[model samples]
Target chain A: MEMSALWKLSYGMYAIGTLDGERPTGCIVNTVIQITSDNPVIAISMNKNNYTYDCIKRTGRFSVSILSEKTTQNVIAKLGFSSGRDTDKFDGDIFAWEYMDGLPVVNENSCAHITAEVITMTEMETHYVILARVQDAKVTSDYNPMTYKYYHEVIKGKAPKNAPTYQAPEKITDKETWACQICGYIYEGDLTKEPEDFVCPICKQPKSMFKKQ
Target chain B: MEMSALWKLSYGMYAIGTLDGERPTGCIVNTVIQITSDNPVIAISMNKNNYTYDCIKRTGRFSVSILSEKTTQNVIAKLGFSSGRDTDKFDGDIFAWEYMDGLPVVNENSCAHITAEVITMTEMETHYVILARVQDAKVTSDYNPMTYKYYHEVIKGKAPKNAPTYQAPEKITDKETWACQICGYIYEGDLTKEPEDFVCPICKQPKSMFKKQ
Candidate 1:
């Protein structure tokens, strides 16, 4: 199979929020689909290794925050590039949220927010397909929901390694570049020339996280 | 739940082709999602009542034609608006296709085509979520794939009742108009002023199929 052909499949960006014990934790995903209309059901594919996946599996509840073009990359960097097991994803007020039935939902730059209870899960080798019935949902903003394609081409974002739709690393040119060890954000320049305080703009990782590539 | 919030979920438009006994049959869908990257797997939700859904259940193999913005609206009108059980969708050459592993794949205005064998199915009250592993796939064009948002706002297409994503009919403006009973193409202004041979531009159905709304 020519795997790149799958790129034609469209998807929206979303932050799946669930709690790890009492801590608000989540990660980014792009495979959410509305399955049924009446008492609508939604399906989202989460990699088995995702910390948020374990949280949802345990709690049986999750909330989806639909990210839009206006969304800051920091939200993705904090929740997506880093593991919720080691990081407090809701820290430093990177995203605004309100707790709904003990679940945190990020409303900043969100087109909509949906809370659902897991009804079923179809297990795959690397991922678990979670089917949830929408319990409560609301439109948060009129901003256009960010498309995965837009995230790549417009925002120049890279997918987290654990993302189900993650593609293998692409061939890089012979240009001097510094790549983020965490998020793989390629800084196309001579990194040594920049100040030590420089950090990965996409993932907000420190300069020490940069690897010459 | 505010179901309208679900509308923010993005999806690509597709022509789902499968065999109905010995005849080639298909329908339009916007729910196809790639679940895995390695040995790619795809999942599509089909309303249980749809004829094409039954066909896929029997055939065990199906092809997905990723529709592009350039796709003719008639492809959707024929495959989406009309029932394959009653209409020979491929008879009128409404779409261009070829046989792939004995499954019909429409390639006209398609960004890609994927042939898959059913791995399993998740049963829901109103739909069946078919998970299939990609057996063969090819990128056919460089055209931008048609998104469901573009299909609705740009193509002005209405969802067929059998579609899993089908929404209730939107309120129509009170005006002198005639709508095609077959495909819901509304013709504004006095319908009586049109020629006797007037037909729904999208569905190619005759004026007799129109009803004042």
Candidate 2:
């Protein structure tokens, strides 16, 4: 099978939110599709390793923040690249968010948010297809929803290691490249000549987090 | 719940192909998402009323043609707006297609195609979430995949009545509009002034299919 064929499938970027006990925690995901119209039901694929997945399993509910074109790469980096087991993902001032139906949701640059209660969870090898019934939904802004294509091409962002669509970075033989240890974002040019305060745009990590390849 | 919030969920345009007793039959769908990466599995929502759903359930196999931006609106109209049970969707000169893994798939203006076998079917109120494991997949072109938004905002296409994302056309006031009887595409101006043999760009139907609103 041609594995690259899978890349042709289109998707949108989203931030899935759920509570880890008393704290807010979540991660980034690319799969979210509506399954029914009346009493709408939606499905989202979450990696078994995701902390948010464990939270949803415990709480039986979650919130989906539909990221917009204006959503920053930092939002993806903070929620996607780090583990919620130790760090607090929603504690920083990087993005604005609020609670809807008792679940935290990103609202700063998101177009809409939907809170759902889990109806069923179908297990696959590495992921779980969580089917849920929409309990509450509201449009937050008029911004256009962000497609995964826009995140890759326009924002020059890289997928997290646990993402279903994650592909290993291609070897760069033609340029002096620096790979960010935090989020795997690559710097194509000389990192030493840049300012001391330069940080990885995707994950907001300092230059010290980059390693020359 | 604000139903408009559901519109923020993003999706891709696709043509699903399957066999109806030895004849090729399929329809257009917007919900297709990868559920697992290894030995890739995908989930697609099919309305219970669709003929193709019965075909897939019986045949236990199907194909997905990832439509590109260049795919004409007529493809959506023929395969989506019409019923495959009574009409030959791929028999005309509207679009080019070929059989892959014994199932017909649209090749013209498509980026890739994937053939799969059904693994499970989870029933919902109005739809079934069919999970399938990939049998074979191949990239046919390098064109950008078409997102549902592009089909609506750029091609000016309307969703089929059976689609999970189907929304009733908002009443147009203060303008002369003509609606297609077969498909709900509305022409914002007078259709009588176009030509002697004007056709609806969406379904390619003749001027006779239009009705004044």
Candidate 3:
């Protein structure tokens, strides 16, 4: 079986929002699918190990922030690359966000959002297929929703290890590269030639966070 | 609740293949999502009324032909516009297709296909959420997969009523148009103006099949 074939399956990137106690937390996912139209229900696959999955299980509610092409790589780095258990994903006022139905939705370059209540959840070996009923939804912007293909081919981003689509890194040989230790943004060529103030383009992390990969 | 907000959720077009007794049958859908990467499982939302759903229930297996940007509108009209219960979807040599793992996969303009076995299913009011384990899969082309947004805005195709995502027809304001009775393809001008030989651009059905809208 050609595992690469699975990459052809298209998906949209999303910031799944939920609350950890009174604190808002979430993670990025690509497996949200609308299963029913009337009383619209959506199913999202979340890794069991994800901190956001535990938050959703406790709160029994979640929100979907539909990421669009305008969403910056920093938003992905803040929400997707880091774990909520270790640090506040929304700290430092990194993402311009707002509260909707008591759930915090990352509004930076998001086109729409849906607040949902967990109706049921089926446990998979590696993930939880959580089915949620849409409680309320709103269109945030008119920008086109970003497809996973666009994220990979255009933004040149890689999936986080917690993502269901995550694959082990393949050996890279294009040039000497510096990769962000926080997010996996690759910086091509010599890092020493850059200015002292330079930071990771995607994660906005200082040069100290980059390591030769 | 803004129903249009649901439109912001992105999706990919796929031709779902299954078996009718010993014959091959399938339909087009936009709700296939990979649920897990390890051992790679997927879930597809199919309306209970669809013939392909019944086929999968009985056969316990199906294939997903990932349609790419290169896929023609005719392929969507064939598998999407017609009923697999009576019509031979694979008949009339409509698509250049072949079998993979004893399942017919529509190859024309397909980027990849996954043959799967249904492990379990949850029945909703109008649809069934089927969880299937990947038996085998292959990448057929390197072309980018066609997204549902591209199908609507670029290909100008409309969804069949049976689709969970189908929206009610919008009020039309253009010069009197004719629509295909089978595929709902709108002809911008008078169908009578074209030669009698002219057929529906999407379904290729004769002019007699058009109805003034």
Error of 2 at B184 (Å): 8.4
List model 3 lDDT by residue over B127-179, tens digit each: 88999999998999987688888788656645454444333223234478777
* Candidate number with the higher TM-score (1 or 2): 1
Candidate 2 Cα misplacement greater than 4 A, ranges: A157-181, A184-207, A210-213, B157-181, B184-207, B210-213
What is candidate 2's lDDT per residue for B97-166, written digit by digit as tens?
Answer: 9999899999878999999999999999999999999999999999878888878865563545454433
How far out, in Å, is residue B178 in model 2?
13
Q: Name the 10 consecutive residues with the lowest summed lDDT in model 1 chain B.
A: B164-173
Which DockQ value does candidate 1 get? 0.38
Each candidate: chain B TM-score = 0.78, 0.78, 0.78
- Evaluate fnat for each of the predicted models and list the values in order: 0.75, 0.85, 0.69
Model 1 over residues A21-75: C-alpha lDDT tens digits? 8998999999999888887889999999999999999999999999987775556
Each candidate's lDDT (Cα)?
0.82, 0.85, 0.83
RMSD of 2: 8.7
lDDT of model 3 at residue B37?
84
Which 10 consecutive positions of candidate 1 chain A have the poorest summed lDDT?
A164-173
Q: Model 2, residue B126: what's the lDDT? A: 98
Recovered share of real interface contacts in candidate 1: 0.75
